[model samples]
Target: MVLNYIWIGFFVIAFIIALIKVIIGGDTEIFTAIMNSTFDSSKTAFEISLGLTGVLALWLGIMKIGENSGLINALARFLSPVLCRLFPDIPKGHPVLGSIFMNMSAN
Candidate 1:
């Protein structure tokens, strides 16, 4: 959590610096012009980030749904034999084998 806060601080500082540069470097007009253009690059960037986050959320939700639907269990069952063969030291029917298979399938 501390690391997360530190990262947030870094981003805030970076954003402040960029804003200051734009405002004080006689670049405010250029920035305003860019913002006025139909392209609106800054807005585009924000939209892209929003879309990416939404897509990530959708994927995570889908994965959770798949988990509840037993897709992961089926995959684990299907891969268990191959997993057991790959890790001979792990007993054939051990719970660890299923876990390993599940982790691999998740990845």
Candidate 2:
């Protein structure tokens, strides 16, 4: 995932460089064309990011509601029995179990 982001960064940088080159090396028409293209691309990217952020926020809010409503706690309760059997040395209701459940629920 990190590498994917690095590649996307490289692509954006290359696009900006190309736009700069077009503005510098060409006439007024080329400059306008480049500017318009860049504006459109930026707007599209902004909209997509905004939509994704809204969706993510909604999901997080839903998850928070679930947490507060004890649904997540119920899930943890259901899993705790299996977890206890798997990790026999760990005490029931240990902090580790709670932390693990919290982390899993968050993801």
Report the error of model 1 at residue 73, Å.
1.3
- In terms of lDDT, which candidate is strongest? 2
True lDDT of residue 5, candidate 1: 98
Tell me how far candidate 1 lies from the true structure as C-alpha RMSD in angstroms.
Answer: 6.1
lDDT by residue for model 1 over 1-107, one digit each (tens)?
Answer: 99999989976776676588787895656545544653676688899999999987987787778677877667766777787678878865566654575567558
Task: Please give, for residues 1-107, the per-residue lDDT of candidate 2 as tens digits.
Answer: 99999999976886777777768875436546667887999999999999999998988898788778877667767789987887789887665765567676668
Candidates' TM-scores? 0.43, 0.52
Worst 10 residues of 1 by lDDT: 29-38
Candidate 1: regions farther than 4 A off: 1-42, 85-107
Write out the backbone clash pairs for model 2.
none
- lDDT of the candidates, in the order given: 0.72, 0.77
Worst 10 residues of 2 by lDDT: 26-35
